[model samples]
Target chain A: METLAELEPGKSPDVPQVLPPEPVVEIKASRTWLALNLKEIWAYRELLYFLTWRDVKVRYKQTLLGVVWVVLQPLMTMVITTIFFGKIVRVPSDNLPYALFVFAGLLPWMFFSKAITQSGSSLVGSANLITKVYFPRLIIPSATVLSGLVDYAVSVVVLIGLMIYYGVGASVHLLMFPVLIVLMTILALGVGMWLSALNVKYRDVAAMIPFLVQVGMFATPVYYPSSLIPEKWQWLMKLNPLTGIVENSRAALFNRPFDWLSFNISVGIAVLLLVSSAYVFRRMEKSFADFV
Target chain B: MQSIITVENVSKQYRLGTRDASYGTLRDSIVRSIRAPFSKSQSKKGNGVETIWALKDVGFEVKPGEVVGIIGRNGAGKSTLLKILARIVEPTTGNIKLYGRVGSLLEVGTGFHPELSGRENIYLNGAILGMKRAEIERKFDEIVAFAEIEKFIDTPVKHYSSGMYMRLAFAVAAHLEPEILIVDEVLAVGDAGFQKKCLEKMRDVGEHGRTVLFVSHNMSAITRLCKRAILLGDGQVLADGTAHKVASSYLNSGLGTTAVREWQDLEKAPGNDIVRLYAIRVVDEDGQLTDVVDIRKPIGLEMEYAVLNPYHILVPNYHFYTEEGVCAFVAQELDEHWRTTPRPLGRYKSTVWVPGNFLSEGTMIVGAAISTMDPVTIHFHEQDAVAFQVVDSLDGNSSRGDYAGHMPGVVRPMLQWHTEYHVKEN
Candidate 1:
């Protein structure tokens, strides 16, 4: 039992083993509606680079397949989604091949979910770095988001292969893909910022997040297409920003007409959350070293 | 010179034990909010029951190139003051303004990733210690040289020896050339040689005109590094002046120190039933107790113990160590009568005199021991049981010869030198 307790994460009493990885710092407990400091984050941009680099390096250090698992993770998930929802449930694929449909939707969902899960726990995981140095605290979770891009790129290669197998090609409308990626990242960052901050104070969020992400996978159309849902309820689905991203990821993969209306709403909500959640993070950051 | 750092009326208050349960869920927060109105905390009048003022209304100014030592016992706010100066944590009230780029070695190896190679960790740890990328690149060779890990620069630090790891950490910290350096007991790690090297590096940093705020409980180190010292007690500044004056005062003000210590309780005495230590003392030749012994006079360490089961040959010994951790000597009862014969059960007293003009002027920690060499076993050993100061008048009769510029030695024994008149012919 003693050994078991010692094996617990964040239980190490040593200095270095217990602090959160950090890249910037500010001290204030303000009541301001928004307190995001772009300048501070800008100043620590090099540290941000190192943090992202550290995460990317440490992730695959000892794994036998190394970075191959990056592509493999999404590929396996896509196959499972194809079997369960595409074959058994027989979700409508909007005149597209079922394999192609599910993979496209899974790409954005995978990116968003991985980014959110990693970044959401990033602050708490970086307990060792946070307590020791003075850096912009926002960099930890943001760096997590940045590192997820590596895995996302690997998975995108698999997606491109699926596209070729299905004989689908991209048009100029595919240019919106990067914009969609950016919106998805911002959405992840916004929620991740909120969750990471809350996780610092109440670690119950750490236990709650994986369950939420699982439920969120089903809520968003990863395997099933949005068209399969009735039209009346489709408006409510758009409120979840992942719905817009996954649908457009499919459109971008197939070069369909961009849904500018839902896309605009999604980007707007993403930007709004990114701003406000960053504010909440900054506000709580003052007591982070004290409490974390 | 203008002051490079100014702090005024700084105080830090912390809630005791609040950290454990501070991380409650959203539902708990909601419950707390709903119960707030009906709570009776207002009737308690904010009396600070759970509050601890780690630092209270403290103020100081540090000029560029002034190395200041903060001396205190545990929980005396030394660390809190250093943290505030480093901006690691903010004071509850008041403000501190630092004029230049600040670097702090609050803990060594702040972010040395064990998975990374030594070379990579150098950059990572350097950046964490406030070195920019280019700055680290420039000092790369010097850091490797200082750490003496050039051969293993490409190896992962997880495989390095603990000493090597500490050297790498301290090397990165020591190489940081910030305008103001803040350190907190970082020298406490590493071996003695490494500690000496670190002190030398800190001395070099001081010579480069960087203002330094060094916090430490190591008084000898405090005296060696700084010209000024601040003594903190119970969250307040008790003394602030020259390093020698303040350091000695801090030592004198500490608890659990005396010229004599006695244990009357039989069960609590520092020994087994076979032999229980009754008392120990630092006494002058007249047997009167004293802490300060002159260089020309022999001082005595007296020990009295009760022997229950006799017919056992025992050695009453004391190990003396200087404050700088140099062993002075180990003395024990080695009389021929006691060496070859057993004694009857009775109370025994022993006094060992440190010869006159032997010890240097400083504090010496005495460790008392009672042991039987037949089985090579120690019955009892008390580390740092008592300590005393040695003094010299510089009257030209003893080792410190009428000259003084910080006499350096573990033993200042007066030695004789002879000169013959026949030497004039040469």
Candidate 2:
């Protein structure tokens, strides 16, 4: 019988040992641009899931209340708002119960605020990871925002309990809750990307976030409705993205009609800010490890 | 095999400044932005910012299945190159083309959360290294077995010992099947046995047609694992070729020379006013200057100093340290004979001889200090006065050749050895 080596005549020439060739793709220089490579991110979806889950686990781990802290945080904030703004300042609640109205506005505001605050500091807090590994830096802030949603979900339950206690009937328009939630997330993330990138180079941004958040609470229409403002000034209030969100959330859940003009403007600004901030973030992200 | 990574003329420049710029408040930024339109200073001072090029026009290529070593002293741009290749930082100039997924172990336990368990940290670290959850699960048992911390898998990592933490961290990094893996000096941790195991695992990884870029100070380990090595000096590649050739060039380049006298003024030196060290020299027994000192012969340390005033009791102390900065031996003149003598104001000299077989093959540093006694007052104390090399006394002729190669700890003394045999059988 012929030997296996002899059977294949093409392998018998010089019998030189074959070695693997090196990858020879050459990268070219071009004008700076922004592209998400969403397909690649999608392919690595399993890794993203694990990373997001790890963030949730690491966050609640070793805590005294575990996941219950999620519920308690927003619940306490709602109570505080009820006492200070609902009872003391007597802000109008658009004919809905003061507690329920503020809670509706507070729900989205709390989610947006927490997401921005946590994700703003996320890069600096994970310095060791940023300096050591090779991953999309956006994942850090994105995961932080995703993890805050857990608390948002828990807080929603408490809001439901409050509505039931007040004998308020549910509206069919409440189905739009998810869309409003997405809008709030996008707005928070847009600002978060800018702040996180800035925090790597200037840590003072991280230090100042709490003070900024406090000021933002008064700037937004959380305790009162945008309807209280004169019609001419209402357009100016729409410039603040959260104005449309808070008003629409109340209108949707309390059987009030949507504010079409403010809603359209809010959506437009949110999308624009998200795209521009993401572009700037990707541009600066390439230097995060070194500067951080 | 195909090349997995290509680097061409890559350079990274950075402007080092305070973490928080002083002019960073919102009002200040707004003012600066408004002034930018009217002021020529902004346009002119754009060139005034101080910049440093951490990497300078570097170029290299890594073929698939090749293990490359990057050797350099601290701040030689080795980490900069690794970070650029890992895409953690972008190069200011030039470009690097990566063909596939790249994983970098720049530090051990980087992404491990203290509150998370060892198992959770493993998954988190693996995902940060770009491994899918299913892939980590596939290698889960092997990683646990390799780390040898089975009982503590569910325990929080903060509760784990430092050694156990490093083991698990290295195991996660070792199991990552990226096309290219970049590792810094994380192997310096852990015990010798674990280091050996890690090296073996790295060899296995290289054998599986993956590219590796290793940066380390251990020349022997680099020679054993890497086929090609690059030597960096002053942010530039000095040599790149076969591992043995590059390592030999680096070692023989007189990079360890300590003869240059770069001391600051007497006030800046760590000494009091009574006595001050002017210079230190390392010489052979016959008084010939040399960098390498043999352990089989006597070595001399010459110290020159100035005494300001007359002192009743004078004491000179000499300390020897290993290359790794561990103090090996300290000798002081505590005898009564030296305490009674008085010294005049002038230059004073002290010499100490290290006897034969007193040290193994390694580098050592010498520190000198002078003080007066009666009430014991320190005058001059200079750390890292000088550094010299020591060669092993016993060669291959000795039965304990393993001990002759490399000995741990600070000092290697020639202890007494005896061997006896008795015939009991008829």
Candidate 2 TM-score restricted to chain A: 0.86
In model 2, the runs with Cα more than 4 Å from the true position are A1-30, A43-47, A202-204, B15-42, B48-50, B256-426
DockQ of each: 0.16, 0.28
For model 1, residues A206-266, the per-residue Cα lDDT tens digits are 8898899898988887777777778999887778788888888888879776666678778
Model number with the top lDDT: 1
* Interface RMSD, Å, model 1: 15.2
Alpha carbon deviation, residue B366, candidate 2 (Å): 9.1
Pairs with steric clashes in candidate 2: A19-B1, A20-B1, A21-B1, A21-B2, A22-B1, A22-B2, A22-B3, A23-B2, A23-B3, A23-B4
lDDT string, candidate 2, B158-228, tens digits: 99998899999999989988767788878877876788788889877776666789998666567667878
